[model samples]
Target: MTISANLALAYPEIILAVGALALLVLGAFMPKQTSLVATGGVAVLLAAAVASATQPFGVAFGGGLIADAAATFAKVAIYVASAVAIPLGQPWFERRGVKTFEFPVLILLSALGMGMMASSGDLISLYVGVELSSLALYVLAAMHRDNAKASEAGLKYFVLGALSSGLLLYGASLVYGFAGSTLYADIAKAAGAEANTGLLFGLIFVICGLAFKVSAAPFHMWTPDVYEGAPTPVVAFFAAAPKLAAMMLFARVLADGFTDAVAQWQQVLVALALISVAVGAFGGLVQKNLKRLWAYSSIANIGYAVLGLASGTSEGVQAMLVFMILYMVDVTGFFACLAALSRQGKAMETIDDMAGLVKERRGLALAMTVFSLSALGLPPFSGFWAKYVVFKAAIDAGLWGPAVIGLVGSVVAAFYYLRLIKVMWFDGSAGATDKPPMEAKAIGLTAAVFAFPVVLVAITWLNPLAARAAQALGLA
Candidate 1:
């Protein structure tokens, strides 16, 4: 189809691309100010993305590209989260006297890459799409090059990211060599008892590589260092949007490209899921830094999402989508609470620093409590239902052990989260007296953004989310 003919279904990404370029130019002339000034650009782009989301699904370029519901939801998450993360970082950039223009541009580029990956139908296309996103993030993680922690994060992310990309490329080449095509549709068409063993090996390598991006354990060494070292605001971005993109791509690869190989991958996912949950549950217990604890929490959370993926059914994929959405909300809320805890001109990082926080900021403390509970998958709140949906999918698929273990991991995770809560509310620190002079309205706004889905899941019509997931998976 002609590009113009295909335009409406892709309005969100086109707007993002155009906005990235415009910002590159516009920001150079504009003075450095608060992050909220960039709100206009973010809003325009987010609106475009949301607008495209409700469009009809279609194939473009002979299945080399797709425009569909799954891509739409991914774009929605990316735009909305970017809108939040950008403002949160603005104050840092303005204070440092650095150019903030390129920052939004990079996010736009990353979002574009994510949008492409969401719709890619072939391995070559998917790899290119993923690398585009990764390249942007590598620069973003390092943007604050003078900060030792930021530098370290950039270096670590670059080194590990390169390795993962190499592995993924090699696997893609092997898959292409064996199957003579990289398109997921073609791969699905070709699979059967006579499916080439090389294809299977390539598949394993691809999964291993993708796991690193999502920070699933065994391949997760870089996560804590990167999260702790990068600016807390940057870490917030890392934890939120990119994950939704990676998880969506992972789902596409499994459901669309390799549905025939579900049995092979199901075992692999189960193993990763178990290790992630165990390591996350234990590792988080000893973490002193809030970001690191959340990093470990992210690992365990990915495990729960993976458990849903391993179900290898339409319902399974929908549950995974819900998990990603809910996880995004919980993390964003937690980050907002973190940002809100700055006292004496320092953003709080260590758990001990949070003592008497409830005394200082009652509303933020309550928000943190809600977010912590959500992260632990506790009841009545939105996170509980996120876990419930996934666990139910697992049980339905006869994956009883993973489902039951998932429950145990959730309980184990609660221990550390509660530890932080206790510090905020009960274990008052000796000198925890400082508070931000200015309110973090962007932080609160983002927290509200994150909170909506939680309420949506708890109230009427989860079917909308489920239907979106099914459409994204192209179940029709």
Candidate 2:
């Protein structure tokens, strides 16, 4: 490919990279202008999203990267999620005395990695993208240098993230050594023609690495601590966009690169899904900190998504996209609401803090209720549709046992969400204040806007977008 053509194929990533560097330099010279930097970063992301949408699909850089329909859709979703997360972080950053230009720049850089992951067609490029994103996230987690919790979260994430990356790199090396190529297409051809033991070992290791990235069970130990200790806005970002990018990569690596290895990977995916569902459902039941509860909730939700991918069919991919889109909205909204819930300028952190929340900030309270119910996969809500599509896909693929297990996990998870509602509506304040800080109204409004889809998704035109996403992946 010509230089211009490769640049065109990677236009969004180029824009993001340039924007991040500019923002970094600008922030250095004008330390007090961090907000402006953030605004500019968001505008850059929006522009990149548009560019990504308009770009033509094809292999670029000798098949190391691609700009296909699926990649475009996933890139756009990540951009939107990252954009939404920016403003939500503002209040927390200010309160923690951590407001700086680095935060937005890091997010943009991380997003660049996510975009690369979505577009990557080779193992080397995919590994590069994962590390770029993970490194940014590690810094973001520890942004509040003065906070012990933040420091701990960052250190733990860095350690575990590095370990996972090493595993992934080792797997890539094994695959390359055995198949004599790093391009997914070449690897696919090689694996399909011969059942090489080294290749099988490499595939399993790669799955393990990706599984850790998604916070799947047995590899999810870092999630609760990271989620609980990181700043709320950062946690919100952590819970949504990065996971979507990683999952998209997961689906692509399996469906596009290892299609012939379906029997080999399917059982592994099912086992991870089942274990995640069980752990997430039971783990949240005893949590006092709301963030920790949400962490466990995220784990279970990932299970539902993986179950969809376990089918290894276009319908399954479509179902996974549906589940993830709705999941993103609910998770982002829930955290936005939590970010808005402040008493005497400090953000609320526990179930008790939510006591009598309905009496004041009714809008936030109601949004929270809807989001909680949606997270539980209740009917008439988008979350219900999300789970339904995935569950149906699993059953259709003759995985009735996994489907039933998912349904049971949903039922168990509903208890904690209901408990949150009960505390907000029926319990006493127990000395916690109810008034949201003056800065929180915007966060509350953001939460409300996202909450709309939770109830209206079934009736709204958004249903078609899910179909479009399916088509993007050639699944519809």
Q: Which predicted model would earn the best lDDT?
A: 2
Q: What is the overall TM-score of model 1 with all chains considered together?
A: 0.94
Error of 2 at 256 (Å): 1.1
Model 2 lDDT on a 0 to 1 scale? 0.86
Give the 10-residue window scoring lowest on summed lDDT in candidate 1.
433-442
Q: What is the TM-score of each candidate against the true structure?
A: 0.94, 0.96
Query: What lDDT does the true structure give each of the candidates?
Result: 0.79, 0.86
Q: Write the per-residue lDDT of candidate 1 for residues 82-198, one digit (tens) a residue.
A: 777777776665555565667777877887888888778889778978999899888888888777888888999999999999988888887788778888887766654476788
Number of backbone clashes in candidate 1: 1
Count of backbone clashes, every candidate in sequence? 1, 0
